[model samples]
Target chain A: MINKATEVFVSRGYDGTSMDTVARELGITKSAIYHHVKSKEELLHLAINRGISALDSAVEDERQRTGLTALERLRAAVHASVVILIEYHHSVTLLLRVRGNSDVEREALEQRRKIDDKIRALVAEAIGEGGLRSDFTPGLITRLLFGMVNSITEWYRPSYPVDPEAIADAVTSMAFNGLEA
Target chain B: MINKATEVFVSRGYDGTSMDTVARELGITKSAIYHHVKSKEELLHLAINRGISALDSAVEDERQRTGLTALERLRAAVHASVVILIEYHHSVTLLLRVRGNSDVEREALEQRRKIDDKIRALVAEAIGEGGLRSDFTPGLITRLLFGMVNSITEWYRPSYPVDPEAIADAVTSMAFNGLEA
Candidate 1:
C-alpha cells in the first residue's frame, strides 16, 4: 500500500497529491491506510529508505569483493547502482526528484551526498594508481560522472528490453576512452 | 511586468502556476496581464523564444566563421550557448523544464535536436582530424557533452561571481581529460 502511495507521490509530486488520492489509487479507505501508516510523510520516508538501502547494499557488496582494482570496483559499484535503479524505478525516481524541501527530502539528499563521496574516493584511488587520467580535477570529474549516470534515469525505458549491463558497459567504455576516429 | 511573470512561471512551473498568482506576485490585476499577453501560454512562448533564438543564432554565427578548425568552431559554439544561457536565466530555466507536452514545447524540442545535430557534426569532423580520441562512440560523446552543458541550468547560480567562459573551459577540460594520476 505504501509502495502504491510512493508511485502516486513520485508521479504527481508531494504537494499536488493527497491521502485521498493515494487511497483512491490503492482502492482502499483512508482509515485502512491509517491502519498501516500514520501519515503521507511516513510513506515518503519508507519509499526513500527502500531506495537508499538498495543502493547502499549494492555498494557494500561491491566493496566486499576482492582482487579488483579501484577502477574495477568503482565500475562494479556503478553497475550495481544502475541495476538497483532499474529494479526500483518508481521509488528511485522519487529519490531523484527530492528537492531538500522536507525532512525526508533532506535526509535523501544527505544519503545521496554520502554515496557521491564514496564514488569520488574510488575515482581518487584510480587516479593515484595511474589507472585514470590525472589532468582533470577530481571534483569536476565527480560531477561529470554523476551527471552522466543520473541522466540515464531521464531516458531509460524498461519496455525496450535492452540489457542493463550493456548500458553500464557502454557508459564505462565511453568515459574511459575518448571519441576520436 | 513580463519579467515578474517569467519569474513566477519558472518558480511554480507552467501547470502549477495560475494567472492570478502571477498577478498577485506583481501586485496587479489579472486583467492587466491579459493586456500584455492573450494567455499564460503566450507568456511561455515569449519567454522561451529568446533562449531558443540565442542558441540557434550562436551556432549559426560559429558556422559562418572561417579559418578555425572544427574543434575550435565547436568550442566557440558551445561557449556561446553557456554565455547566452547566463544572460537569459529565466527563459532557459523554462526551456529546461519543458516536457514537450504542448505544441510550444514540441517546437522547442525540435529546435534543440537541430542544435544537437549541428554540434555532433563538428564533433565528427574533429574526430576525422584526430583532435579527439577515436575509441569511444561519437553518439555517446555528443550526448555526454550536451548533457553536461544542459545540467548547468540545474545548478548554475547567477549570484556567484564566476564567469560563464570559465565554466565552458572547465567543462571542455573535464570532457577531454579523465581523472587519473
Candidate 2:
C-alpha cells in the first residue's frame, strides 16, 4: 500500500496527489487506505521513514563494526548508504525531493541533517586518525561524496541491470582512490 | 530582467512564477519587463540561455586547448564547468531544474544534453588514451562526475568565503588523486 502511495506521490507532486488518486492506483477503496493510515501526510511520513530508518540504521551498524579503522568504517557506511539508496529507490527519491514546507517535512529534514552530521563527524575522525587526506575540509568532502552518491538516483534506474554493489564499489573507488588509472 | 526572472523562477518554481512577480521583485512596472521580453517563457529561455551559453563556451574553449592530452582537456572542461556553475549560479539552477515541460524548456534540456554528450565523449577518449581508469563505463563516470559537480549548487552558497578556483582545485584534486592522505 505504501509502495503504491509512493508511486502516486512521485508521479504526482505531493500537493497534487489525493487519497482518491492513491486509492485508484491501488484499485482499492479510499476507506481501505484510511484504515491503514489517517491521511496522505501519514503515507508520506511512513514512506520516507522507510528510507530514513534504513540509512540511519545502516550508519549505526557501521559504527558498531569492530576492528575497523575510522576510514574503513566511513567507507562501509557509504557503501551501506548506496545499497540502501538503490534498494529504497522511490523512498530515497521522496527523501531527496522534500522541502521543509510542513511540520512533517521539517522533521524529516532535521533527521536528514542528523545523518549528514553523523557522516561529517566520521569524515573528520578519519582525517584526525590520518586515514583521510586533510587538504580538503571534512564538510566539503562529505558534501561532494554524498552529492555524487545521491546523484545515482537521477540516472541509475532499477532496470539498468547494474548491481548495487558494483555502483557502491565505483563510488568508493572514485572517492578513496581517485579516478586516475 | 533575465536575472530577476531566474531568481523568481528558482524560488517560486517556473509554473508558479509570473511576469508580475518578477517585475515586482525587480521593483519595476510590468510594462517595463514587457519592453524587455515578450512573455514569461521568453524570460526563462533568456535566463537559462545565459547559463547554457557560458557552459557551452567554456567546454568548447577547453576542447581547443593546445598541447593538452585528452585527460588534461577533460580536467580543464570540468574545472571550467564548476567555475561557470559558481559564476552563473541562478542560471545553472534554472537550467538544472528544467523538466522540458514547454518548447523553451525542451530546447534547454537538449542543449544540456549536447554538453553531456561532449563530456562523455571526452571521458571515453581519456580512457582510450590510458589517462583514466577503464574500470567504470564512460556513461557511469560522466553521470557521477557531473552529478557531483552539479550538486555544488545545493550547498556552495555565494556567501561562503571560498574562491571558485579553490573549489575547482579541490574538485580536480579529489577527482584525479582522491582523498587519501
Candidate 3:
C-alpha cells in the first residue's frame, strides 16, 4: 500500500498529491492510511529512506570488494547504483523529486548530501591514485560523472528491456571516452 | 510585477502558484494580472519561451560561426547555454519542471529534442574528425554530455560569484578527463 501511494506521490509530486488521492488509489479509507503512516510527509520520508538505503548499501558493497583498481571499483559502484536505482524506481523517483522545504524534506536532503559525499570520496580517491586522467578538476569531474549517472533516472523505465548492467556499461564507457572520433 | 510573480512561481512551482498570491505579493488586484495575460498557463508559456529562445539563439550563433572546428563550436554552444540559463534562471527553472502533460509542453519537448539533435550532430562530427574519443557509443555520450551541461540549471544562481564561463570550461574539461586518477 505504501508502495502504491509512493507511485501516486511521485507522479503527482508531493505538493500536488493528497491523502484522499492516496486513499482512492488504494481503495482504502483515509483512516486506514493514518493507521500506517502519520501523514503524506511521513510517506515521502519513508520512500526516500528506502531509496537512500539502497544506494548506501551499493556503495558499502563496492567498498568491501578487494584487489580492484580505483577505476574498477568505480565501475562496480556505477553498476550497483544503476541496478539499485532501476530496481526501486518509484521510491527513488520520490527521493529525486524532493525539494528541501519541509522538515522531512530537509532531513532527506541532508542524508542525500552525505551519500553524495561518500560517492564523491570514492571518485576523489580514484583521481588521487592517478587511475583516471589528470587535467580536469576533481570537483567538476565528480559533478559531471554523477550528473551523467543521475540522468538515467530521468529516462529509464523498468518496463524497458534494457539491462541495468548494459546501461551501466554504456554510461561508464561514455564517462571515460567522450563522443569525439 | 511579472518578475515578482516569476520568483513565486519558480520557488512554489506552477501548480502551487495562484494569481491571488501573485496579486497579494504585489498589492494589486487579481484583475490587473488578467490584463497582462489571459491565464496562468499563458504566463508559464511566456516564461519558458523566454529561456527557449535564448538557447535557440545560442545554437544558431554557434552554427553560423564559420572556420571553427565542431569541437570549438560545441564549446561555444555550451558556454552560451550556461550563460543564458543563468540569465533567465526562473524561466529555466519552470522549463525544467515541465512534465510534458499538455500540447504546449509537448511542443516544448519537441523543441528540446531539436536542440539535442543539433548538439548530437556536432558531437558526431567531432567524433568523425578524430577530435573526440570514440570508445563510447555516440548516442550515450551525447546524452551524458548534455546531462552534465544541463545539470548546471539545477545549482547556478546569478548572484553567485562563479562565472558561467569558468563553469563551462570546467565541464568541458571534466567531460573529457573524468574523475579517475
- Each model's lDDT: 0.76, 0.90, 0.75
Model 1, position A120, has a per-residue lDDT of 84
Best candidate, TM-score? 2
Candidate 2 local lDDT, B71-166, one digit each (tens) = 999999999999999999999998998888999999999999999999999999999999999999998889889989998988878787778998
Score candidate 3 by TM-score against the native: 0.84
Descending-DockQ candidate ranking: 2, 3, 1
Looking only at chain A, give the TM-score of model 1 against the true structure.
Answer: 0.91
**Model 3: lDDT of residue A90:** 79
* Clash totals, every prediction: 7, 0, 9
TM agreement with the true structure for every prediction: 0.79, 0.98, 0.84
Candidate 2: which pairs clash? none
Per-residue alpha-carbon lDDT of candidate 3 for residues B1-181, written as tens digits (9 for 90 to 100): 6666777788777777788887887788999989999988777777788888899889889967999988888777877777777777777777776878786777778888888888888878777777777655556667767777777766667765557777776676556544444
lDDT of 1 by residue, A1-181 (tens): 7677778887778778888998899999999989988888888989778888999889777866799888778778877887777677778878888889888789999998888788888888878877877765566566666666666666666773456776666566555553322
Interface quality of candidate 1 as DockQ: 0.38
Docking level of model 2: high
Candidate 2 Cα misplacement greater than 4 A, ranges: none
- Model 1 lDDT per residue over B69-148, tens place: 88778777877877877777788888877888888889988888898888888888878788776554566567766766
RMSD of each: 3.8, 1.0, 3.2
> How does residue A33 of candidate 2 score in lDDT?
91
